[model samples]
Target: MKRVSCIDIGTNTALLLIADLDTQEGSIKPVFHKQTIIRLGKNVDEQKIIDHEAMQRLISCMTDYKHISKEHDVQQIIAAGTSALRDAKNRMEIIDEVVRACGIVIKTISGEEEAALTFSGAVAGMEELPETFSVIDIGGGSTEITMGNAQTITGSVSMNIGSVRLTERFFSSQPPSEEEFNAAKEEINRHLTEHLPPFFEAREHVYGVAGTLTTIAAVVSGLEQFDPEKIHNFRLTCEQVGNLLDMFRRQTLNEIMDSGIPEGRADVITMGALILHQFMKLLGTESIRVSIQGLRYGMAWKELQKLVSDGETTNSA
Candidate 1:
């Protein structure tokens, strides 16, 4: 039983997954899972660079993850940086700092690769899946829509419309005004309309993964603490998404914080809900099934598969 770790450094948060991978069975037994919101994409959209404060926060978070991985004696760590890093002008500074400090190389993955990995991870552990489906991963700086089946990915697109980017661009006041909400919704709809139709032609079932969807599931379930089991595979209807969007839009940041929306996410969850809502409306889907599995899971699975393949080749030779 070998333990491997995977880290997904996104625009909004950094997530780490440490698991005992059973190569023979192709199963992953989770050992530790944690996420920290470092706002790594802060100002990246407007300034085109990672801010100094945000970089420090990300470094601290990665350092902590490194310590935890060491504690678990992880044999390998695969870290991938997404939208924020890809967009930032000064990304190499953060990458250099991370390697110098934590001894982990950060791979800045392209949008297509991100979508492919997400598609693989989102469908890996599921007991049931449609013959054809879509996986929508909404991150902080970008949204990845991947359509494929159990075996291969056919069409995938990553758009620049995300919760943080949308909120920063549209929401000007506390508890955004109706005009602001409408404006944001329209912008998101426009982006999806342009990019998502090709993938939606034949895909019927859409599964929503990543923080935004999971947080909505937690708040909707009214759980005092986050629960992956309850969130995973939970079906959310278009009407429910609309109702939640309305409910969240009226509440101030403090109110949302008080309502058990995860800390550091209260400000952007409303926009996130809106993104999900607009995506469903564009695709004409009535509901989306949420999955806890995401990029980190997909990375870990890929690594394990490679190891399995290497072993088989050596044994045959």
Candidate 2:
């Protein structure tokens, strides 16, 4: 078994997952998981660049993750940067800085790859894996929806519409105006109608991942703080989602936070929630399963596959 640390640096947050990979069994046992909200994609949608402050936060967050990985004595550190990096004009410069200072290479992956990885991660370790399922990962700068099964993905699409992107575009105030809300909704609908693949239609089983879904699950379950145990595999239905959206529309950022939403998440939660709401409407599914494990976990499993393949190649050589 080899210990591997997988870090996912997203537009809104950075997550770390340290796991033990068994080459023989082709499985990964998670050791530790940590997430920090750095909003690395801050204003990337508008400015098309990762600003100075965002870069600083990225460096600092990676430094901390590096230290934590060392504490676990991991054999390999795999880091990935998603939509935030993909949109930022200075992404490579920021990634290089992380490599130089934190000694961690950050891979800026395409949206297609992100959706595939999300599908893999969402279904990992499921006791009763669905025959076929779709994964919707609502990120800060983009949303990835992929349809797949236990074996492979059939289709996937990564939309440029995300919570942070929409919030920044339309919302200048907490609890944005009704006009702003409708505009955001219209934009989301436009993206789905134009780009979403037909494979998603009639797919009953769906999994929701990333901060938006998990946070909504948390609030639905009435937890005082973030709890992964109660979150994983939790059911989020269409009715509940609609009610939540109505409640969010009535509440300001501070009010949302005071009601137990995670810091750095409450502000954008409404937009995120709206994305999920519209997505469910398009799919015609009553509910979706929530998955806390996402890109970071997917990266860990992919690394294990690579590690095992390399070992086989080495032995044959």
Candidate 3:
């Protein structure tokens, strides 16, 4: 019952999960979880830095996570940052501030590395995955697409089209009109056309991971509680996604928040739907299996293996 923790600081959200890993079973599962939505990249494009407002909020959350990790007697924490910090002009400044305030040094990883790690995590949890599968990781500020065989990753691409950026640039107005949604869809299609050729040319089963795809799972399942097991391997039809987009557009923001959906998720849910719809169209896949595991899970598993290996050497000596 040894515990480990991982912190994934993405553009739209900062997630922390501390799990009691039964590595003796060759699988990793989280017994405890904590997440905070600081929206770190709130205005990075305009400010050229992590916004001060968002940083303050993140500091508060990270400070709280620090306390929780200690209280739980957790050891070995790995932290990473995604698109926002990757593209920001003042990323180091923000990273310094985070380290200063919370004792967490966040690594801003490249999109390719993000794709590879996510693939490793997704593959680890699956009963069976296709030999020629495509894995897509959609985030707040970027998306990573990997083409892989059953054994290893073949090639990958990371694009800057993400839920938050797309929503901000195109669907800023709530309950976006058809014109707005189409414009965003067209842009997403254009980007996909330009960037996704190698992965899209030959596809088997496309696995989707991240909040966007999971929200689709949530909407389709209509579950008030977020259940990873139920959503994992769940598929949604293109027509179903399209229909939901249409219906979602008719509802106001207040209506969306008032529903069973969590308040922190309200702002980008529609935009996330739009992104996934376009991805399905471009891949010509009617449906995609939801991957509940991503970077946080990946980081934890990697660290756990290293720890167990080190422990074995110590015991032998």
Candidate 4:
């Protein structure tokens, strides 16, 4: 059993997953999984750069992840930066700083690659998923919608509309005003309608991944603490999503935070919910199945395959 560490640095959260890869079984067993919301894309939409304070927060989180990975004796560390880093003008500065501080190199991945990895990770262990379904990853900086089955990806699209970006752009008010909410909804609809392919609407089974969807599932389930087992494969109907959106819309940021939503996510949960709501409406799905497995899991699986392939080549030679 070889321990490998995979880090996914996104706009809102920095995630660390350390797992033991069983080469013979081609499976990854999780040893540790943790997430810290550093808001790396806090103002990237407006400023086009990762802010100084946000970068510091991200580095702090990475330092903690590095310590944890070392404690677990991880053999290989794969760190990836998405959305925020992809859009940041000074991403290299941030990357260089991270390497200098934590000795971890972060790879900035494109949106298409992000979607593919997310799809692979989202369905990795779920045996009940429909043959043809959709996977939606709503991050702080971008939203990736991938349509695929167990075997192959049919089509995918990555849109610039995300929770942090939308919140900053439209919902500046604490609890967004009706006008702001409608404006954000309209914007999300416009992006999906104009950019997403027709196949997205045609998919019958849709699985929601990432923080926004998972957090919403946790809140809706009335959990005092977050639990992945309960959240994974959870189902949320369009009506339920609408109900939650209305519930969130009426509450202030503090109230939402106190109501079991993650500490740093309260301000943007409204916009996050709206993103999910609009997508469900556009796709005409009654509900979405929530999958806790996401990019980090997919990245681990991909890395394991590469390692195994290299080993096989060496043996053959």
**lDDT scores for all predictions?**
0.88, 0.88, 0.79, 0.88
Residue range 1-317, candidate 1, lDDT tens digits: 57888999998989999987777777777899999999998878888899889989988998999999999999898999999999999899889998998888999999999999998998787876788899999999999999888888889999998888878889986599999989998899889889977877644698888999999888888889998889989988888889988889999998988988877898899999999998888789888889998999899888878878877323210
Model 3 error, position 76 (Å): 0.9
Model 4 per-residue lDDT tens digits across residues 1-317: 57889999999999888988776677778889998999999889998999899989988998899899889888889999999999999999999999999899999999999999999999886777676888999999999999878888988899999999989999778788889888888899999898666656445798889999999999889998898999999998899889989889999988888888877898889889999998888878888999888999889989878868867323210
Candidate 4 lDDT score relative to the true structure: 0.88
Number of clashes recorded per candidate = 0, 0, 0, 0
Which pairs clash in model 3?
none
Off by over 4 Å in 1: 201-203, 312-317
Give candidates' CA RMSD values in order.
Answer: 2.4, 2.5, 2.6, 2.5
- lDDT per residue for candidate 2 within 1-317, as digits (tens), equals 78889988888999999998877777778899998999998899999999989999989998998999899988789888899999988888998888898899998999999998988988788878878788889999999988878888888899899999999999888788999999999999999887665656535889989999998999899998788989999999998999999999889888999988877999999999899998888768898999998888798878878888888323210
Residue pairs with backbone overlap in model 4: none
Question: Candidate 3 — what's its lDDT?
Answer: 0.79
Cα lDDT, model 1, residue 290: 91
Model 2 pairs whose backbones collide:
none
